[model samples]
Target chain A: MSEDKFDAIVVGGGLAGTVAAYLMANAGLEVVLIERGNFPGSKNMTGGRLYTHSIEKIIPGFTAEAPLERKITRECVTMLTDDSAVGLDYRSTRLGKQGSDSYSVLTSVLDQWLADKAEEAGAQIIAGISIENLIVREGRVCGVIAGDDELEANVTILADGANSLLAQKIGMRAEFKPSQVAVGVKELIRLPASVIEDRFCSSDGEGTASLFVGSPTAGSIGGGFLYTNKESVSLGIVATLSTLVEGNRSAPAMLEALKRHHAVAPLIKNGKLLEYSGHIVLEGGYDMIPKLIGDGVLVVGDGAGFCMNLGYAVRGMDLAIASAECAAKAVIEASGQGDFSAESLAVYRTLLEQGFVLKDMKTYRRFPHFMDSTPRLFDEYPRLAADTMEEMFVVDGRPSIPLRKAVMPHLKRIGIGTLIKDVRKGLGSL
Target chain B: MMEYVDVDEKLAVDKFYVDEDNAHIVLRELGPGDMMQFHTLELACPAGLYECLPDGTVRFDYAGCLECGTCRILCGTTILEKWEFPRGTFGVEYRYG
Candidate 1:
């Protein structure tokens, strides 16, 4: 092969890399994007929700032509126990209009389409090539070498996924401890559109996303999520790696247990299992994020641990894109000055901190730690509350006590003092 | 409807086994005849027990095996032994690990 020099080399063709390549190429820079998979998103997976704001910034008004499955119109958070579930559901027709803020997207379809957009903008994407290592010269990363091919560039961007080998190779991140990561296993269950709509109580083209906090992981320190697709449902469980190790459970067994749950079985009763996939997620909030910018390279997406699992939704893809866009802008600035030093790349960190990508992470940095230490909130509290309510409202032949009396006994049974402490901790963390 | 016959026509032996001394343990057959059974077991250990290969395969050290089977499930292929260490020392000892 010929040795070609580009202005920038992007290692990883996921959403972050593709967006960076797109922006750089549009700005009239020669860029090459190397992907390990057969295509941009062949090995990618998510819970099927994409925020429109960040994506629109990259490609304006993409929803009109993008491969979007459904507009998210309703969101539900269910606190479940062994026998009952207490849910908070919200539906808004305002979020289902032509220009919605978010939509459910299949990553395989969306990433492929985004790659096409990047290629249209003159970014050369070479797929099915695994980047072996970063070409470091004098303690500075200058390019990437992939399997007998050495590509030279002024700067290299690492947009590899959570289990990023490139970032580890360059010493941008250390070996991830189990506490800082999570293993998520998801299944795309195929069902008729009508059946999905009825099951989720959604209309045509309107979707629902539900989050579960208990029984799914079997009292582990993680949660479960179910997102509605066009003709399928994306259901999965994400547990802290440390929790999974401590609990002696496997992700597949947890998924099977979730499917067997009384509260979850009815929604996927007759659905066909179309595909099963699993991926690692960095869930340690802001504290677990690695060095964003190095001497001659910048890391984006899960490589930098830019994910927020806020008990209600997972917001990493948009943050990844936003961070990549910030890095692209920094690259443009660095290119003008002909400098690719650590000082020049520090602008990427400043931009991310100014945006919601890091600000939100810092705001809820204590969430994962708090959730891990409080298992009773996920398992016992919800059940006790539901049982108390059931007893108060059942009203058999026997005389019924006051509502306050029924609730107080249950609260006392679980130690009201500890419950209050947990509430305080939860409120503080949120 | 098409009728299916059992390929192994020998007497169906009771595959369920239990250690009489250990009441907490019970093992049962996972599949019918001519099928490989994959048993999952969990053990605790610190890091450095396994190494991830270039082709995304992980090799476990026999002496430091935790027997977690995390490597097996993450491999995405069924061409692994996925075994455990012997019931003795030379394994993981996790204390607040």
Candidate 2:
């Protein structure tokens, strides 16, 4: 068969791949974006609140034309014990306005839009083609072999989502251990617009994104999330595979249990279940990120494990978009020099390192381990707080002691001194 | 097998928030272990399409899926099934995914 060569061949047409392809093509380079899916976004899902800063940086005024569900106005963090929860909430008027914090979106729609942008910018996107391996020539990367066809390019980009086999095949990413990744299962339950507004307590076109602890997984490491969409709620559970396997549990069941949680049920109650999906997320943070660049190849998005789930908000798509832009910029520079060797592609890693992608990952590298070591924050503390609250509030004809006095014993029972130490460690890690 | 505690029972013991308006609700802290758990959950769902069979079961299909989450979300209360897209990198490629 004949080889079809181009200035660049981008494998896995997700956010990172699409953005890179779009940028390259717009800069007047020949680019081919290969996607294994029938279409862009057909198989993608996220708890998915899109951070607009990076996206707007790539495509200015995106909020006006992007398929946005709602501008997030409220955010909450809930600590749970099987049946009850205590939460911290933040809501601001400024957050509800456009071009502000972020918007909750479905990746399917958003990705399709992005791919179209790439197409409009003159990149050729071929969907439903599975790329089996990378074409490495003379120890310098060259292109990709999809089935029987060899597609050559000056540079090839692997944006093939979190489980990025292309990167693995090319030796850029090592075989992933269970600890280096996360499994997230999400349900898109269709609720009436009014119900969603009333349930989450948001005004028209305003939404809330909340994170949960406890009920989603039995004592395993991971959490649950719920993000309000235009007419539905995206609810899901996520946990580590090693822990799940060690604990002998299942993820879908865990997601159901999360939906069954008292705090989550009413919001989803009576809502029709529309769609459910899941995907593995690279939670390896900075420590697990693989070699990002090599001869004729660059890695971006979850393929590079560029997500930061800091327990406040899950920020992967924004990082993916940023990294893709960086890769595109690097590829553009490489094309100008007519070189695609490791030296030329090293710019991708350099740009990412200088940006928040690597900087923030470095900052919070210790957080995952610290949180893992202290399971009590999820298991013990919530129970203690609940006990204290109950003891301090109920009136049953006993001598009425001061609320503070009533709760002191419960605090002692759970070892408040230890709790304080954990908090100190957590603050330091974060 | 130990009797599994109801979400409400667990919540009562832990002091998780129960929206009097809602049922079986509780919130807990997330740690590294939880993050790993999330990753596993994510793989099980795989683009939110298809079902995960019981242990030692393998299934793959390239077509007949409506891109729905039926088999996945409702496994066994519905019956376990697998409906995967192409291997070696297949399924949705969201520009934003």
Note each model's CA RMSD in angstroms. Answer: 11.0, 9.6
True contacts kept of 1: 0.02
List native contact recovery per candidate, as a fraction of 1.
Answer: 0.02, 0.22
Q: In model 1, which regions exceed 4 Å deviation?
A: A94-100, B1-97
Winner by lDDT: 2
Query: Candidate 2: deviation at residue B80, Å?
Result: 18
lDDT digits (tens) for residues A251-326 of candidate 1: 5566666777788999999888665555677888888888888887999987788999888878988998999899
- How well does candidate 1 score on lDDT at residue A245? 56
Can you list each candidate's DockQ? 0.04, 0.12
Docking class of 2: incorrect
Top TM-score hit: 2
Error in Å for residue A220 of model 1: 0.4
Prediction-by-prediction clash tally? 0, 51
TM-score on B-chain, cand. 1:
0.29
Cα deviation in Å at residue A86, candidate 2?
0.9
The 10-residue segment of model 2 chain A with minimum total lDDT is A241-250
